[model samples]
Target: MAQPHDAPTAAELVAAVREFLERDVLGSLEGRTRFHGLVAVNVLGMVERELDLGAAQDQAHAARLAELGFADDAELAAAIREGWLDGRYEELKSALLDATRDKLAVANPSYRS
Candidate 1:
């Protein structure tokens, strides 16, 4: 699905490293080393998902924040802290839920499932 280029794309390279850890590295480890390898695998999975979805997620997040009359996250947070959104609790809850779901879709899709 990628444009014409070499065989190994950046995502593929990351997947390779992740697989190596999942197989070879984890096999020879125990205790903290194994735990670290597991953590590394989780980190790599997040990285791969970010590589696939970070751009679109960024655009959606910014647009949603703008829709609430804020420029960005910091502005939105400031407004919330100042009790500006108190009258829009339902809207705020919906927006927050959508944002959290989007984040989980990247960080841990299975959890969403």
Candidate 2:
């Protein structure tokens, strides 16, 4: 029950998550404990992956967009870059949902990516 003002450091957060999963989720499970363990491991893996490459991913995406002649005013550039950094994942998620809906209308519709 740590407040926002008591924000944990990265290591502390990882440890806390591990402890919670072990004590609350996995500890109570019997037959499905292995599945829960796998889920926990996958979650930790995803967190580690993001921590390792999040900045580099943003920089690479921005550089590619710049190379593609996406120049704009300073304010526009800042806005676009911020969206590219933070919103790309959400945008892609929405687009995927839309594509699935479109597929229901027509079989095997072409997807951009």
Candidate 3:
């Protein structure tokens, strides 16, 4: 009997991370350092989480845009999708913040008080 190929174990992931840290991060360092190993492990975990949720995040954004009438036109929908895929996170966040501020200004003219 053999284990299923689709089911990957935690130990296997840990071993792969260890090997990556040793070969890529640690090996690139000029001297023996623990910081690079720790950083590599942390980054690897972050990347794994992002990979797992990236599609769901995009879908959620697309759905929200459609609900908000942002996707009313095919050209607009395509532009929105392109902007999302090409835009930086910080740029998107800042744009959202500005839009919120503008909405608040229109809704509450006395907000300055």
Candidate 4:
């Protein structure tokens, strides 16, 4: 976690820009420009959330796939489609839920709540 960057770190830089957009840019624009600024703010928020949660989510997903004896997502999808886990429906359901929650925690955390 050593932030050996020049001055403002990545998170700090993102925060600064987001604050600027929210406080300054958003109010100055009208019509389509304002709409686009709103979208930009949302996209920036998503990027910040991903930066916060993406690494841990990826690690957990890879570990889950490994535990399930699959090399990757495609293999897992193939197994699911072929009804290979029919007997373990509950377990599969829980795993899929966890995966979805993890993704949503980054993509749209409010939905997870």
Q: Against the true structure, whose TM-score is highest? A: 1
Candidate 1 lDDT, tens digit per residue, 15-90? 8999999888998999998899899999999998988888899998888887788888898899999999999999
* lDDT minimum window of 10 residues, candidate 3: 100-109
- Local distance difference test scores for all models: 0.88, 0.54, 0.55, 0.86
Error of 4 at 4 (Å): 6.9
Off by over 4 Å in 2: 1-8, 15-30, 70-113
Task: Kindly list the per-residue Cα lDDT of model 2 for residues 34-92, writing each as its tens digit.
Answer: 68685875576456445555566556545544643454335435755677545466654
Error of 2 at 60 (Å): 1.2
Off by over 4 Å in 1: 1-7
Per-residue accuracy of model 3 over 1-113 as CA lDDT, tens digit each: 13654546544575588677867767566543677676666666555544454466556556645544465346544765777435455644554555445444434435533
C-alpha lDDT of candidate 3 relative to the true structure:
0.55
Q: How far off is residue 103 in model 3, in Å?
A: 24
Candidate 2 collision pairs? none
- lDDT-based ranking, best first? 1, 4, 3, 2
Inter-residue clash pairs, candidate 4: none
Query: Which parts of model 4 are misplaced by more than 4 Å?
Result: 1-7
